[model samples]
Target: MCIKEGLRLHSPVAAISRETTQDFDLGDRIAPEGTMVIMNIWMYHHMEKIWGPDHMEFKPERFSKENIDKMDHFQYVPFSAGPRNCIGQNFATNEEKIVLSKLLRNFTFRLDPDHKS
Candidate 1:
């Protein structure tokens, strides 16, 4: 849950662009094939309507089993989604967990007041 929250708040890739393979309907209009679609993953992750008013805050509980179902499956895409997603995504996540576990087991971490993000 913590890792998922971290990814939600800070997705590695900010945006992605793809060329349309066919005419896509947008309800009011149609984007013909060959058009370039730019998806802003960062902006999508911070949507108030989907994530609530406190969207920007770091709250890991948002991914708790009880609350997780409230979200759309596609809303969280730190590695992008579908078949074209990063092949190393699973490996990377497992590696993160292992590294994080070792680090937490070995050290204590605290925010530095002098450093402002």
Candidate 2:
């Protein structure tokens, strides 16, 4: 039995645009005034240092108990961290699970010439 990669790829939000309502200090880092900050999700995920040597590989074993717990929660963030993270992130998870289950039950998948799974 085999499984096509899941959660190995990420499509980051093109921009991180948000409005500030109040003044707050994030530890030593300070965000002042009505600042509009933008972050590139793809760049962060693809960085060699953050994801390690085989960051580009689709290795499900990366999510194993020992490794998962050891990883930096703040850095391996497909979904940006904090209160302004993502509203629909939960829905995406549920949807992925359902799709995976259905795929598992219905057919055998392979990396064929017709289509790339």
Candidate 3:
């Protein structure tokens, strides 16, 4: 859940561009084949309609098993989505967890008095 929250708040790839493979109807309009589509994952992650007013808050429990199902499947995309999604996503997520766990277990951290939050 922490990892998912981190991704939602700070995705490595802020935006993605792709060419449509076929004519697609977006309801409001139709995009022809070969049309260039740019998706801003950062904006989506922060949208109040999708994530609520507290979207900017760092709340990992939102991804808990009991609450995860309430979210849209595409709402928390950090590695893009679909067939063109990042192949290294799983490995990267695992690596982040391992490194964070080790750091937490081996070190004691304190905020500096001069630091501003």
Strongest candidate by TM-score: 3
Q: What lDDT does the true structure give each of the candidates?
A: 0.89, 0.65, 0.91
What digit string (tens of lDDT, one per residue) describes model 1 on residues 1-117?
999888889887788788999999979999999999988988999999888899999999999988878878788998889888878889988998999999999999999999977
Each prediction's TM-score versus the true structure: 0.86, 0.69, 0.87
- Please provide, for model 2 over 13-83, each residue's C-alpha lDDT reduced to its tens digit, 9 standing for 90 to 100: 54466655566476898777686666677666667877778777787777777877897766555556688
Candidate 1, residue 53: Cα displacement in angstroms equals 0.7
Sum up the clashes in candidate 1.
Answer: 0
Q: Of 1 and 3, which scores higher on lDDT? A: 3
Model 3 segments more than 4 A misplaced: 110-117
Worst 10 residues of 3 by lDDT: 69-78
What is the overall TM-score of model 2 with all chains considered together?
0.69
Query: Per-residue lDDT for 1-117 in model 3, tens only?
Result: 888899999997899999999998999999999999999999989999988899899999989998888877787888998888999999999999999999999999997999876
Among these predictions, the greatest lDDT belongs to 3
Which of candidates 1 and 2 is the stronger one according to TM-score? Answer: 1
